[model samples]
Target chain A: MSVEPLDPSTLPEHDNLPGNAHAYCVRLTGPLFVQTGRMIAHYPAGGGTIRFEPLTATSLGTLVAERFSSPLYSRDWVVANGQGHVLLGDRGYDINSYDLDEGNLTVRAANLLAFDAGLELKESIVPGFLTLIGTGRFLASSSGPVIFVEPPVRVDPEALVGWADCPAPALHFDAGWMGHFLGAARGALFGTRSGEERQYDFTGAGTVLLQSSERLREDPHALRRLEGEVRQLGPGALQQLQAVVQQQLAEHQQQQR
Target chain B: MSWRLRTPRVLVVDLDGSRGSAVRARTGSMVACEGEVSFKDAGIGGGGGLRAALKQRVAGESLPLMEVSGRGSVHLAVEAGHVLLLELAGEVLRVESESLLCLSEGLRTDVAFTGLRGASSGQGLFTTSVTGHGRVALLSLGGPPIALRVTPRTPLVVDPDAYVGCLGEVRQSFVTDVSWRAVVGESSGEAFSLRFEGSGTVFVQPEERR
Candidate 1:
């Protein structure tokens, strides 16, 4: 018996193919489905059919890189979908996204860390770090042991607070010199050097999540000044300030809602 | 024949220098005679001459304890089975009582106020005249007796309730208007204050509201 090749335009798209599945496919004009942990898919009108295409090791590596390279984009609010929540600051993320499976989530950006199933990430103005607080599998771009957390764990973002160890450690320079050097190469002599005065870097193992934007460590001096302002307010004033901040947050959340 | 009477606490004087002689009563219960006794004038004095003249009139002997009933009665249980009761028909003046701490020494004493003001203000200006060297004792309710010492240099402020005793020579001025409004409450801006000057001790209680 001879089988005809299906056309890509007529078929549904399956972005991340789970590794556990023996084979998975979506027919043109028909349902795209998976049969590994369970049969999963969405089908069109009646013409579609599926065929088993067993994933090879090379294909799995390609799939991981593709997924990591892109940011998760949803037209509808991600939190509103009941999949997961996002907290931009010191607060914890209240994730309600069930049926959601995490692939090898990579956090490679500067001063970023994640703990607790990648739900809680603390972003500081000073050296940036990510702390995970839930028992789940997570990967990092730096040389850190794979952390398996139990429930109710509090991972300190500062613990993972290190710069990416790279040849261009001078990438983490004070804002004054960095700005001057970037504007023109004339002040490149004053630019930060590698070695004793080099920028701290984290390198070795694990995948990391990096924001497409600049990392906090790019300007350590400015970050320190910002952190100092927050620290000088003291605990009492910090609470009152937090309330005001939370109000602004609520407004932002309402806008998103 | 005539005999002289002598006692450790008082100097009993008789015109005839006779012992146990009945003296003539001139005004009310006061007896007058051509006799001299050793006593000190401790009340507020107008001047040297006036103080001297007032000091010459008082009899220093241990007078009989007069019984008083109605109101504002001052009584002291003295030594030798004698109780001193000062009955005030009008405001008593220029008198000093022995300090309560030194009760054993009956002769050496301090001054006190007996019924300076009557309960009824309707009575038309009643005043008792005293021309002598004497002392009076007063009783204060609540708490132990507080001794406020007043010297020429040291002055004190006291609540009226805590005033137990005062020197006859010390001048007194009343102070009022210390309230929450003048201190802690919202109306603290328009608060009032009291100024006390001169040589006098003022006693104050810890809890004034009660």
Candidate 2:
């Protein structure tokens, strides 16, 4: 087999795509918050026009509503904007491309995948995380390769993938499952066990983004943050949260018989 | 067409069985083979006869090949993705019979209709092409196989979920754009895009097969 055929005049000016680390090739000269369908191929470099928009449209729409302040993930994000070269790709994971310069990272909003509208997207009190504050270039994607630990680490809540400059994770559990959830019949018999006794600990002082595949990647803004916390429950706390979710679906169908 | 890549997603081939060779693959994609191999059923159509088996069941474009040939060395792969290869000589590759996989013995495969965007991506506007010469591999997933060059003033625009497979004579079209169907379903999965211009070469694969 005779390989070698990349063309786009030898791609790779903004990185990855040579022997692919899950593809990425951004050379576009302005605006690029991309995420909308991770664009696979793009080539212009001459007769302008790239466009992707959608951050509530209207072109740069007030600079993407003033730097896309995550409305539970500004409807999947977009704004590839003009010039040429774009090429991004995810779902085959392992993308990389960081360089935040003005710092602040966070990521794991489905492993990011393209940024640089001069960064600034927020919304990340953990839940399906995403921070990105300022200073250019970003492009994450990781199902593997992104292990830059350092910190009192605890990880493994599905291999936690987000933490740069730390301060979020703190729910370690596992003190013998908190003494079996402070005993109440071993908290209903180890509370239907297998939460793997949780983890995520992290402790002060930066960097943590792990990901050698704990296989997550489905967070649709955590169902819009549980429908905005079930629209502020009421009605006797939604019938006591529906009888504790029908006794946790009859103890998960009695532990699947 | 010898075909070697023992790993880049595996694919082997060989075949000499004292001169009586063979190939076909892609129905349960082999995985191993020594000497004197066998395995039948290149059936229903992949053999390309009976009017290319009624145009591969009226172009639902199924493929399902498997005719391995004799005299050792098979081994192919599929679900681990990434395999690429390619070597034709007459032209015409088209692809997407689940991104083909193995095809050496005198090549040919059919089906072509490609109209309303592979039937709105549910994969049925048809497109399997192939043609003479030999060697064709291809299996893409998230890596290996980026090759985009389509000239005539360079027009490419892919992303019909990272559409994989295209060799030459290009010219595809589809685009849509009504603000990409007004940012449909909050983008991240196509509001239509497959543009490609004539001249050839365009095998993408950085994930996105939805």
What TM-score did chain B of candidate 2 earn? 0.35
Q: Please give the RMSD to the true structure for each candidate, in Å.
A: 41.3, 19.7
**How is the predicted docking of candidate 2 categorized under the CAPRI scheme?**
acceptable
**Cα shift from native, residue A57, model 1 (Å):** 81
Alpha carbon lDDT of each predicted model: 0.26, 0.79
Model 1 agreement with the true structure over A35-88: per-residue lDDT tens digits: 111111112222321221222212233432332221211110011011111111
* Clashing pairs for predicted structure model 2, backbone only: A37-B188, B17-B71, B34-B72, B35-B72, B36-B72
- Candidate 1 — which residues are off by over 4 angstroms? A1-257, B1-131, B178-196, B200-210
Write one digit per residue (lDDT tens) for candidate 1, span B13-49: 2332332222211112212224342222222321223
